[model samples]
Target: MLDNAKYDQINPPSRLLMGPGPINADPRVLRAMASQLVGQYDPAMTGYMNEVMALYRGVFKTENPWTLLVDGTSRAGIEAVLLSVIRPGDKVLVPVFGRFGHLLCEIARRCRAEVHIIEAPWGEVFSPDQIEDAVKRVRPRVLLTVQGDTSTTMLQPLEQLGEICRRYDALFYTDATASLGGNALESDAWGLDAVSAGLQKCLGGPSGSAPVTLSARCEAVIRSRKCVEEGIRTAEHRDGDDEMIYSNYFDLGMIMDYWGPERLNHHTEATSMLFAARECARLLLEEGLDAAIERHKLHGGAMLAGIDAMGLEVFGDRRHRMNNVLGVVIPTGLDGEQVRQMMLNDFAIEIGTSFGPLKGKIWRIGTMGYNARKDCVMQTLSALEGVLNRLGFAGPRGAGLQAAWDHYQREQPS
Candidate 1:
């Protein structure tokens, strides 16, 4: 047995997070989390919860009445929806483009659903026809996929897939953790039956809370699995005839009751996380969702121009890439990890590495949420130039920063 050691106060060095996600939380969102807590059922607390639901509907660009927060990270929202709606042996079709698509299949399998998969090469996305062909063959009860898979820096085109799912009578579900807020995702217009996302990305908050919205059809499927708790039962012979949702904690039906007008309790709300999520949506709406997406596009275009000027190859198909992140191919003869280390240790910056196939071959740079700004872009490009030069990876000295500057200048109104 080892003795416990004393630790210092919770101060950590400042970092410019230009990695895949969990970017720096906005100052306003941090302040929101620092506010005092109240009882779970306090009138003010429920009122705040209701306000959050309404705010996320605006963020999601949906009028779905079932929008609410899940008290865990992004995956919690994904699992809650999948588990609540999928009975054992139900079929789920997952199209794999990157790591997160595999994650969806694993989660569905755990729900004891029959998981089917189709794969696209990494650094690319699926065509709606390809997915439609699979749906025609399998006829899955759900067509589940990711909107943006950061592992390959690709955003799947979801617009037409919704119509395909509707034609096949399959529920269209997506985990938008990497694409929401700073990207265009129209829930109702896209015919997305269920949508889930975390505050850690373009919404500009810390991780731990997930915001979700459900179309009316998706809500009905979950409602059919409701099993009220023994203690809270008023006059229940059990509401739904279908098998009860397996996991008590992730039961979306029960979570709905908690967030619904009845004001029932599933568990104590994750109060601080709720505050962070609320402020995240508030900040995005304050800026206007379309405007926020445009901001990401502007900064992302600058970053892309800078990377190209630096003579580095981007990993994915540029036409389908996400606006907030990119995968930069690491040139041969230099260690990618060493370059990342120097950027972190010396310049106080952080970038990410690719996963699976692209691992050790590319550097994933991000400009998302609070860190997506002109200064952050210029500083990161400049510092990267210095790091590459020091590592003996020869490139034009100041071209990257100059390219980024020129791009930004062109975008500014005359």
Candidate 2:
């Protein structure tokens, strides 16, 4: 009870977000969050929840009725699916191409699944043939993979993996947090049984909410688990009953019941986060999904071109790189963190560094969602060139900016 009021007040600057995630939320979404908050059980609040589900359905390009937002970050959605669908001793085949692949394997292990990994080096993606070979041998019950791994800025090919899983009667799950709104993702057409994404990345919203969709097959499995839980709860009145549910919060069965027409209470819904997420989806749908993806492609390509003109080596195969993020090699004799910090502190810009094996050797630049604009792209390149030049890296003055501008001129209608 010592003078708590003595604490200092702090404020953060409004810098441009050009990093991997938690990108600047659109102003429209911010205004939406300012709307009056209603009670959890209020009719208007429940109606908003229904609209959120419908909005994300369009965002995910799926007709699955179970599409809803998880109450945590993107990883929370990942855990929800894994903990609910993966039973003890189930085989989960994870194709490890980057850090997120390791994340999948780790989460699967926590769910008590037998995990098998087919690994590739960082900055590369696995070929469909390699995945097919692993599937043939492992015969896994579930194939857990990532659509985009931001750590290495690589997009794993899933077009054929889904078919392979279907052939083996295995479920296919993907984490699309990095690629969903910025890339081409057809959840239903791609044969994905379940997919999860966060609002912070390409969706241009805050990180507290996660959007997820599950196929009929996934829904059926969750429903079966729900029946087991219900039978156990009322076992005293019924003759045949099942055992207890493992983790309650991660139980998708109960979550589905809460989100479904039953509208039962699970946790107090994060109202502000839901408004942000719904508005994010609305912005994407209004822009047209394909058009939004094309914007990311254009901006990301321009950023890569700018970096190349600056004499920096672009990491990853160009054909496999994700359209929203780029990894560039840290020049010799230059401190990667120093440049990043200078960008943040001096230029009021934010960029990212790598993780695991690629840490300290690469810098990740993002051109995603609201930041995928010509001015944002040009400003980031200009700032980066200034930082690198000051740090003693030899590169032509204004070369990166000129190159990006030239590309933009060429792409303009004649």
Candidate 3:
């Protein structure tokens, strides 16, 4: 089974990632990850863990003391929340907007919850009243939604949904993986009970870490089901009536104890990924969250302008598009995958394609995290124009780049 002979040292080709996520991380984050590891119990390591918790509070725009890092990717964070809070037969409502909405439903179903789903067409998001109406009727224990779904390149508006959930006495949770840092997410202000995100997108890091925040209301639900494992239970303990969380690694209660004042042992802690996550939050706070959002908006706007000028049709409702990604409708008579291959082979640039029903019909272009810059937008547009022309889909040579430049010039303050 081994194939060591065929593999070489880790030299990978350089590519400009202009897609949905896993965009190039900030250089400082990588540098931090390279530092040597420390023992899990080491004072310095635990100190960094605490700092990470505090730093992410700012990043998430929350004062919730339960905010902490999950040892896996964004989906891990989602599962952690769902598994800990949702008991068997509990009703959970997920409004399907795109692929990730379906993902939430799937996970909740696996957890043995009674999953109810409402739907909108792929490119559209539900209005606040629509979600509230469902909340009133279904009356789910949790209302699960995604802030941004890369598959559709649409950002669902959450400011109103939170209040709706509170009015109906339901917990509100959102997967902010594609929107956090690059977009506005106010956990406390929005009244969100819990929020989860990944480092691969606007956080400027890879996919190994997930930063999650939980409001006190959500924490109470998780803590109610807390069960100290056999190895960690003391003589004074008694099990609670609530069911134990199904997964050990994703048990947020245990995870919290590890990150909290007790410093209870759970796993050994992913030391390098912890560093990367910490540095991501640090960089974002240093830049300021508002400024980061503005950066994504500006670069993303430039990309839209470039695509528009290229005579390309954009997919989805323009009013609901995410600030970090674009869904460009593949031109008729052009082979979509063929164009993607040329972009990768010749330009060494990576863009994304859609999933589910929209697959093969659109290309997802992202300007996010460290790659959300004037240079990245211009380069991607130029390369894409070249490839399109070469494929016999002819347009003016410099129209794409010119449009992006003009947008930048117009937006620049005097």
Q: Indicate the worst ten consecutive residues by lDDT in candidate 3.
A: 233-242
Q: Evaluate model 1: give its TM-score.
A: 0.96
Cα TM-score per model = 0.96, 0.95, 0.96
Off by over 4 Å in 1: 1-5, 226-242
Q: Over the stretch 1-414, how does candidate 2's per-residue lDDT look in tens digits? A: 778687656766889999888788889988999988999878898898899999988999999999998899999999999888887688999999999989999999987889999998888899989999999999999999999999999998888887889999899999999999999999888899999999888898888888999999998776665334433456442432222246677788888888878888788888999899889999999999999999999899899889989999999888999999999999989999999999999999999998999999999999998888999999999999999989889998899999898778776545
Candidate 2 stretches with Cα past 4 Å from truth are 1-10, 226-245
- What local distance difference test score does each model get? 0.92, 0.89, 0.92
How would the candidate models be sorted by TM-score, starting from the highest?
Answer: 3, 1, 2
RMSD in angstroms, all models? 2.6, 2.5, 2.4
User: Could you tell me which 10 consecutive residues in candidate 1 have the lowest summed lDDT?
Assistant: 233-242
Instruction: List, residue by residue over 1-414, the lDDT tens digit for candidate 1.
Output: 544465666898999999999899999999999999999989999999999999999999899999999999999999998998887788899999999999999999998999999999999899988999999999999999899999998999999998999999999999999999878999999999999999998888998998999999999898877564553543443443235676788999889999999987789999999999999999999999999999999999999999999999999899999999989999999899999999999999999998899899999999999988999999899999999999887898899998998998899755
Please give the distance, in angstroms, between residue 183's alpha carbon in candidate 1 and its true position after superposition.
Answer: 1.0
Model 1 lDDT, residue 163, Cα: 93
